[model samples]
Target: MLDVEVSSLGPGVIERALGCLRNGHHAETDVPYATLSSLLERAVEAQASDVHLVPGYPATFRIHGELAPVDGEALAPGDVRRMVEAILPERVRGRLETERNFDCSVAVSSGGQSHRFRANVYLAQGNWCACLRHVPTEIPTLEWLGFPDALAARLASHSNGLVIVTGVTGSGKTSTLAALVSLLRRDASLRILTIEEPIEYLHPVQGGSMVTQREVGRDVDSFADGLKYGLRQDPDVILVGEIRDRETAQMALSAAETGHLILTTLHTRDAKGALTRLVDLFPQDQQDDVRSQLALSLRSIVCQHLLPSAQPGQRRALALEVLHNNLAVQVAIRTGKIETIESAIQTGKREGMFLLDEDLQRLVSAGQVTLETARRYASDPAAIKATKPAW
Candidate 1:
């Protein structure tokens, strides 16, 4: 029932696919690449964040962070494998076979607009499966996204030092950084260089700033290599996709010390967690040096986490904990008082540092988020309840 011919597949195919899954029968041949492409088209049309392909299941899309089945038939393991192969270029197929997993970016066109996707192709239960995150075609400015304006201006005003926008996966860290870069382009006249793996949001160099984007494994070998050579590229601002390893972190600090503003991301829970993760990346013997270097060269760390907004349409809003490296903050870092960092942030609001709970409370009070949702994600729900958002 799920084996409807690609040419003949049409209305009501989703029901057919679900029935096929119940009966445990699927066409074992290669589904047309256009089949998956059509699913992607539908996903983008629906503003889905990700598309997932798994064996013995229908294609699914992550709409507003929730998974929903795409309008299609259930795919057999072989069918999924073929779908993966169909999307991947032949040159990368060998790497997939040898490595069992690969990361790549692809561009899909639908409705006369091009949408980008970062693809993760991996083996699941010995069957090829893939997860694709839909990257927006246009790079958004902070103002356009309605991110905190003061914070965006502060991040863009930095001429030197390292600024990190940190969060867990699907937390919109990349989009945040991209917006910062766009703001910098509008507010300052500087050359901005970015190094990303397979470059996600293609920012067209515009306004007063010049943007030169390099792709890891394509334009350069790795983040370290691009960052090291970026120092000599006469750039005033550098954006490294993520501080993924010790080597990349070292180079990022080096660039920051050498008078280049380094913007990057780290997969951490909050600003304090980011500092701990950065220092812990180095060996114990080198941690003190890292902390010292970080104390001076760290400009700001904005930790972002998303929560379900009040919009019944499954939308999400950002809650941020912003940390600026002022003198008091620097002293805390230099003294290795990671425990006291949170306290410093609580009192440093005039300098643009605040806790996540503060932002969450603000959202709730503004009617952008519900009180229950805020409590679920807030750092101090009791405190928020006692004293309402002052914003």
Candidate 2:
């Protein structure tokens, strides 16, 4: 069971308490606290992407996109609840009964290194269960995240417009946005502001770039409110965690048009879908205006996926469909002919546009991923074989 005193402490004190107990230092915590920390340590050591704690199962780790159960007895409902409560901060714990499903992140110290994990805890069959994904402490460079140097440079060079990184869940979209912020941080003159739900990556004020990060539940009420107030903060670059609602999409577009560089994310299968998704967030009367705003203020959309790699040691390869807002794309957006955007991407190779299928074929040709793997992820599997590998 969780220690009553530890459960009421703030997140920092809870982290320290867990660290001391995990290191075998004498503390007042109980077995559940130690068990939770130990499991996180093991998951990090094994390089697992996520950890799952559900009733009737031993602790499970997702390694290289495969779930592997640890060698142990299955946890009971009480055991899982106790372990989860050990890490929940008092602020979140107070609202658990009211908000049964929520997301939060924790930082743990293991082997003298700090590891962060984004956790989603919810009720299943009236019992508590949790899913935690490991987040790296260090921000990787854009080039390190597999963007070509030319493309990386182009992404960082944007002064004021909407730059979106779109992908499905667990496809490394957050990391890409954080890396872009890190890239912009190199310029000390820029002031960057980011609003995230549960604030995953904490940006230090390194390189003299001013970065202010705000969490949704903790710092603000919602993404729209965050953006509404964030504009008055006088920021050069603003990163909204995700554009989930119409208010957020409107505010993000407005910010981009008003000379603020807006970096955000959306959930879409491919680049063309991203364009449609944004405009569809509003009613019929507003979509035309939104499309005009997008055509004027949009910069680029990077739609990417993580394909299970065939190469030894490497776990996954990134397949990307990049759409830069060139003249044809702008015309298509302004004229409401979204279907023509794909043809524009196909012909705009000289303008640094590439289709996702082309990237998948490139990966397959380079032996980074199997042909079957590429086919599984391609939007059009027939187009997979039609494209040459050079893009």
Number of the predicted model whose TM-score against the real structure is largest = 2
The TM-score of predicted model 1 comes to: 0.90
Q: lDDT tens string, model 1, 166-237?
A: 988989989988888887888778999999976888888578789999988768989999998988899999
- Where does candidate 1 have its weakest 10-residue lDDT segment? 1-10
**Every model: Cα RMSD to truth:** 4.4, 5.5
Cα miss at 314, model 1 (Å)? 5.2
Residue-level lDDT of model 2, residues 306-385, one tens digit each, is 87779755777888999999889999998899999999999999888899988888888878888888999987886666
Tell me the TM-score of each prediction against the true structure. Answer: 0.90, 0.91
Global Cα lDDT for candidate 2: 0.83
Query: Could you tell me the lDDT of residue 315 within candidate 1?
Result: 69
Which regions in candidate 1 have their CA more than 4 angstroms from the true location?
Answer: 1-31
Instruction: Determine the C-alpha RMSD for candidate 2 after optimal superposition of all C-alphas.
Output: 5.5
Give the candidate number with the greatest lDDT: 2
Question: In model 1, what is the error at residue 381, expressed in angstroms?
Answer: 3.5
